[model samples]
Target chain A: MVVSVAHLGPPGTYAEAAALAYVNWLNQRGQQGLLCPCPSIAQTLRAAAQGQADVAVVPVENSVEGSVTTTLDTLWQLDKLQIQQAHVLPISHALLSRAETLEEIKTVYSHPQALAQCQGWLERFLPSVQLVPMNATTEALKYLGEDKTAAAIASSRAAQLYHLPILVCPINDYPDNYTRFWVLSLQPSGGGSHTSLAFSVPANVPGALVKPLEVFASRGINLSRIESRPTKRSLGDYLFFTDLEADAREASVQSALKELTAYTETLKIFGSYSIVSIGKL
Target chain B: MVVSVAHLGPPGTYAEAAALAYVNWLNQRGQQGLLCPCPSIAQTLRAAAQGQADVAVVPVENSVEGSVTTTLDTLWQLDKLQIQQAHVLPISHALLSRAETLEEIKTVYSHPQALAQCQGWLERFLPSVQLVPMNATTEALKYLGEDKTAAAIASSRAAQLYHLPILVCPINDYPDNYTRFWVLSLQPSGGGSHTSLAFSVPANVPGALVKPLEVFASRGINLSRIESRPTKRSLGDYLFFTDLEADAREASVQSALKELTAYTETLKIFGSYSIVSIGKL
Candidate 1:
């Protein structure tokens, strides 16, 4: 089967890295055809909605940065695309430059999130230089290749692809920086190891979260992640995106979902698929 | 009293805007003095520890985006600067331009967070334009002044200061977009109306969070916010930062803290201060 993958940039981005990893995983299993790259998460989901792509991959959360709200907001808007799978990729940043020395670098460039993640390191090491920002770290790398006095904070893979030398390695403030990505698709697959879904409940209801959680607890199912996003439509309303460590077919899992639908204002099971490791990508 | 402000820029940034707002608030209260504008949160805390400033203001969380991890991480490290006060500022973004029309705008610039916050609007309005990321929204305005085809996503204040016309007003995706700021001080003030603190519990320990939460619940004190950050030193250890409605001096609040400390392995009161409204600024 063919799949369309949507990431953050043209190429050589962490999102692209994650998407490629998924592509390689599918290819190895002899089950892939096309992987289309999109510029933003909204565009990715739009492509899936229009049937231009079968599936899209987007970053959901970063260990150091918490959550990617763009993806969350887009997911909230799109009703067709369901979260089918997930993968966590370790992120290591590097300061890349065309010039040889820090003295030659007058300006540094990177995505704002990348810059923020490395804020402490940049201040301590490169205090006098000006920081220039770009939409994606890959674009920063591109600018670095063209400008002699500018450096870019990007992944090691980007530096290699762009032929920029690494001025500083692992520039992120946290050593264990990781990004969690979700795979979205229109068709729901069965016989998967787990399922991911997003739902919402009435706000300010003291025990609202507990009742849905009890469904899993009663059946002895494990929950991988649970996050809340404000609906923006109202002050108190919240949409909860959750991941469970079991397929929908499981008796307890089905029972939990059946009970959850009655209580929650809205519940949607995005999709079910096998979980894959980064190394497997 | 002198204050230290930690912001996200070298000189001109939206962080600077927020910092200036805090400085103006203090100055208006007849406490006019120099405010040390540090480039990073860590530096701000370091300044506080070194007794360079009496208080520091840092952005803790944003409504549309969620928590600012750097501020949270730096707070976890310093153990000196405590939350003295909290304020929520409404964020209104403007598209600052040196050129008049969208056709002349070759590149759009802003902080990565600002860009992400306006991703929906940007994608729909400017699909083909290049997005230049900068350290702060203010710096993006600087770029716009220099580049004829560039427009910057910045606050209305920046546009007014730079004499750049606003192409689009309130371009952010959400109307309720606001940022939560914390005024941290070296010493706790006796007349505070609210309290903020940080603590941690072992991961996967069932009801570990609930036990500490019960302390405040039993006292009928409302929690304003609760966020989790991974403790870098340990794999599963998480540091939880919480804000409560009542001041630490309150009898019930004090009793709750005493009870909480007993159940918690690590608990620290960060600060006690009155809540400030956005209108007050």
Candidate 2:
């Protein structure tokens, strides 16, 4: 059977690139995969949860921007989705435009996160230009061909795909910029090096949140990341998402999980997945 | 001296309303205050840091959106600023337009966060409308007067200020939506009920993060909020921002803070301040 993969796209988004890499990984493992691009991240994940696609690739975190809240919040809401694998994609943005020089650009457009990632560079170079936020990076590329003063911040692959000139390459403020994407499926993939989960502690307790973390800390299981998002009920009410450096299938992890339930009001194990680091676009 | 206060604005943005509320709070205490609106949150904080403004009121977090990252990141970068107070403004977004009905709107404009806060309502009502994100909500108001198909999401105060008709009010997805703003000054305020601080841990060490949290936990000091932001050096490298339920001036908080330094590579106390919740905009 051909495996169907869904991702945020107009064919050239970072999510699409990550999905392509995931499909390539699947192909090497004897699974044929097809790409399905959706207009937004939420829709892409929902496609997987509803079985429109076999798997969904959604960004969870960015080095420059921190947590992808929509991805985390949607993942928390969708109980059926489970992690099958993970990918670390190095992000390199280029200024795609019809204009020959940066000084000629009057407006720059890209996904809001892309604009934020390149904020320092924009401040120094295109300080006065209006920055427009599009739903996707590739969504802005179509305007570049017609407007002389229009530019877009997107991957170098996007420049090739859209036939736009690269006025400046690697325009991200940091050299170490990277985004982590999760390959989520309806069923759990049991074996992997890392485990990801989210939980909410009983509200207004003095040491409520720390008790859950202590469960892993006592077992020498390192926490790779921990972030809090407002529960949406009110300010100060939060649900936490965390990643741990241990496999959920391990006996020690199981013990920790059992103990964690005692401290948490709501707990979810998003399944365990191995990491795959992509070298290029 | 006429106290100058800087905030993100063009008079009718949420930040301006926050600043105005803060100024009113100052007047109640018998101190004169002035409003200095800046184009961005970063500049608003910088105005206080550079002595251009006596104080700066900037949004730190929102109920639905979580942390105002630009505010946190900017505060972390500027060493001179200290939190003098905090204000929680209940957010209520209104659709302001020349159009008579929602069906007549083809393009909707607002700050990106405002758009996100009302995502559920927009998806159900204006599913196919072009969503344009402006730097400030008020920035979108100017176009609403000329384009019959244009609508901007802003506070009802903005509709009154701009003389535009409100097509809908309280369009945010959640009725409990609110934003928390910080009043920052050069000198540290010696008294308040809560304290905010940020710290980075030594990278790749097992259980390094838990050690710092244990300091507060062992002291019975409650953490109201805990969030991690990328250090911007790499994907996994992080700096934590947390708010404690105890004041920095308190003995218990001071002791916990001293112990916290041993586990952290760098730490910054953003001062302690009491929270003031506003009844209406």
Candidate 3:
């Protein structure tokens, strides 16, 4: 029997590295895992939903960047898929190129997030070079194959995969840059100390959000995050995505959620998930 | 005296339109206003800070998409800039091109935000067309002159400025899409009813944010928005940006802020300003 994990990829992206890391973790637990690379975060979610992959790994939030909207929006839109586990990967970007010298580079390309992470570095070191953002950082590897003048900001794993030379390691502006990826599966894996959920409240009511949060605070459920995304209906109307320290199986948590559901116009549990702190593979 | 307004531009962007609208508003008040086109949001803000422009108008939020991080980050970095006024404009994207028909478009270009806003439309109408994201939607205006196969998702104003035909109107996924732009100036504008502020609380303390809100609630001050971004120090650390219904000069708001500043490690008052809403020109 084989287990398949889907992730955003052209084979060398951080998402792909995360998928490899998950596979490594699964292997330690006596499971044989196969990696399935998808083009977009939306497709990565769909791969798991459609059973092309048993699970999907997609970035949820970044320590530096905040929420990954593509992942968050897709998770919200796809009602059936549930988060099985959460993984934190320290994002250490590198300047990858075929060129021997930085002065020879005319264009630098990577994922927009990657480009943004290295904005300060690119500005300081390669001020005159063009910055092009692609779908995935791995896609930048392809551009450098023919153009010696082109460089890319990507993971060391991307450099290794594409057989490119690393001009500079850890090109990210902040050393503390880290990304949290959520492992998603069609069914709930269960047995997790943490639970993630989203809910929307009536817009017109003042202190509408405070009430639902009070339900958690009253239960002493420590919330790790509370991110508000626009409902797309109007300005100021939002859907709050929250992370709690307890799973639905806990009686106190269940009661709090019941009270929360009553207060919210819409509520969703993204399933219980444990955090996996792993280094990039 | 000519008062200059700076905005993000290639000349046909929403930001440029907002600048023109602001100039119109200023002209109505009998002030001679000059339009200044900037290459980026950072440049636009810098223009005001360096006295290159009297004020700068840049998009801060979208109704459907939410906060503009570039605007938020730049504002946070430039502590001297103050909000003169907030402007909300209806965002209606159109498919603009030299091509007579949608079928003739082999590639679609837009700003990443614009692309995301029209994702559903592009997927439905031109599924296989290559989607390219540029710095501004207006940059796509130049591409049409060279490539008959290229189309851009931008405003009707952009289409007119570029002398291109609108292939599709209101291509955005949501009709409720509106962008809120902030008019920024070096000097604080006095006597506005609305205020915007940001603060960061100690990470170790649970319910730290709750105390700051309680200050507002206790004073009966209405908060319109609360957005949290990563502090970039570590995971779970955040800086909260908030919007209030009352100006800092108001007795109630001042008292609440005084209490809020004491509770948080860092607090910044972005100044009090009223909102000026105008339809997209």
Candidate 3: tens digits of C-alpha lDDT, residues B199-229? 8886634466677877886677777888888
TM-score of each: 0.86, 0.97, 0.96
- lDDT, candidate 3, A39-115, per-residue tens: 78989998998888999999998887788887877888888888888889999999999888999999998888888
How far residue A170's Cα lies from its native spot in candidate 2, in Å, is 1.1
Task: Identify the superior model by lDDT, candidate 1 or candidate 2.
Answer: 2
Which parts of model 1 have CA positions greater than 4 angstroms off?
A101-103, A116-127, A146-148, A166-175, A189-195, A199-201, A205-222, A233-238, A258-265, B1-29, B146-148, B189-193, B205-219, B233-237, B251-265
TM-score values for chain B across all models: 0.90, 0.98, 0.96
Error of 2 at A154 (Å): 0.9
Q: List the residue pairs that clash in candidate 3.
A: none
Error of 1 at A105 (Å): 3.5
Model 2 Cα shift for residue A5 (angstroms): 1.4
lDDT of 3 at B89: 89
RMSD to the hidden true structure, all candidates: 3.5, 1.6, 1.9
- Candidate 2 lDDT tens digits, B120-200: 999999999988878899999988877889999999999989999999887899999889999999987766888999999
Q: Where does candidate 2 stray beyond 4 Å?
A: none
How far off is residue B97 in model 1, in Å?
1.8
All candidates in order of DockQ, best leading? 2, 3, 1
Error of 3 at A204 (Å): 2.8
